[model samples]
Target: MAKIVASSPGKGILHGEHAVVYGKSAVAMSVDLRTRTTVEPINKNVVELHLPDLQTSSEWFIEDIMRIPVTSNEEIEDAVKVSEALKHLQTVLNVQVPCCTDAKQQSIYAFLFLYIEISRKYRGGNFPSVKVTVTSELPMGAGLGSSAAFAVSLSAAFLAFYGKLDKKTPLSQENLDEISRFAFQAEIIIHGKPSGIDNSICTYGGALIFQAGKIKEFLPEVPPLKILLVNTRIPRNTRDLVASVRQRFDTCPAVIQPVLDAIDAISRQSWQLLKEMSNTNSLQKFIPLLKVKFQENILHLLKESLEQAELEIFEAELGCNG
Candidate 1:
């Protein structure tokens, strides 16, 4: 039996949160927390999925998945077909049909979606019998890109299982791109309209600056930073937050637009500082000066853009600046 293991890192937005939605630049970096997927071939013609984080385990015979009669040359070609396949898988597994709010069901659906599509794409419509176990260190629905990490890991593992991966050396750029593409497809199942940055950062394993839906690696040659991920244990709805921001922008463009532009400027400056940090041989010597300048500029911009009441409210609520 062949065994393959692949892992991908979670991500967080360094800057440009709400502004990124409005065609602005955002910086996102992969965190240390990751998700790992293990694929082991089984003698019996069955595909089993074990997602411990979701407290779900399911198995289905390859013959059963094939009997559903859904085929496409490409995995992402037909959304309706994929939905139908998900429904069929849900029925076969005796699981509830997935809704947008149901994270557990959605996760299971994503796993089965990738499993069937990837197997069909690479194995020539012959579903391989394998047991996939996914484990993660990241928390779900925390704006931490946990789902993206899971998707990337699953994509890489399935590709490796299908003999598409080169195990002798480091993964090539082409390999990473393919993995990112598949992961992005899976992400669409979880996030209705994803910006593609999370999967890209997870696949590339570094900092990335995403602008207007385009992604460029940030200091790829430089090693990843040791980031501290402090989970507030707050469960916030991303869609609702985004919608609220949009509504605010629509309601008070004069006020919100300036704040967004100020944030964009701060993010751009931070990106420049990151570039300088990468270039400087003695980061320890330069970081102190850079920090002071960054804070001064950010404060100046925020004060200029926001009203006194707004600034006080922000400081009181966020507790970042006293």
Candidate 2:
């Protein structure tokens, strides 16, 4: 088979950055850039893996692949497991595929997981050793959808290389859906909890409104919503962010409830406007309401009255810069 190489973009939350981690609805996107992977088949039973961006590479004996851990409760562990699984497949097929050394240890794991999982279900083969390389334009951990994008890219690469990807046929929709589901699962392996919005957006490559627990209903396109993401310049861990919110729920429930409720209201209104607003005229009419709700609701939740300047900066950063 020809060398399989693929790429997918990372993403960030526009409004629901932390909220979605707690099963709440929020908006997120596939940013302008991504992580990529390449799978090449070699002649021997040894797999070489390289990740250019991270500057890491490693080789594994295909027969000894099952030694890598596959079960994990966290993203890091999940990533290693994926790597092990890929080695297992290489051994199973008795084919030597050189994996990239450049990807993060965890990203390599995730790549292996996607490749093996997707391959097991759709196609089986034996081949010579090959080289795989991954590159990306996105930052490693900026709350972007780096992990999901990488997973999607791997899935796409495997499907394309196997000649199993059929975008033109309606029967392929089932395969596409199944592939997306597996990709999301792989992401959960990389991210402790993912809203699946990033994968969906990267998978479809456009704008979407994501609602918690509403898979089919929540994913709707909003062409007129002028979306932009502003990083807080502060690197926030998904785990820590979720934990803080959880702590608030446990120790400060009364104080936290209103914030969540108000944010929820904003999300709802935003979705409504996204559906209703079409042309520039409609967008201009809706902009003020959108801005006001976002500012007021986020301000109240942030308890910014404590820091007027902090609140102003927050609003200015998130606000439309004209």
Q: How close is every model to the real structure, measured as TM-score? A: 0.80, 0.72
Residues 1-322, model 1: lDDT tens digits: 4899989888888777667777777777778788999999888889889999988898887877886555444644545555666667667666666676677766777888888778777876788888899999999879888989999999999998888888765699889988988787777677655667778888887677887766854657543345566788888655455565666566557776766676677677777777877876767765665566446545644324444436655767788553
lDDT of 1: 0.75
Top-scoring candidate (TM-score): 1
lDDT value for model 2: 0.60
Question: Stretches of candidate 2 above 4 Å error?
Answer: 66-103, 124-128, 167-172, 216-228, 279-282, 300-322
Best by lDDT: 1
Task: For residue 319, give model 1's deviation from the true position in Å.
Answer: 31
**What is each predicted model's overall lDDT from 0 to 1?**
0.75, 0.60
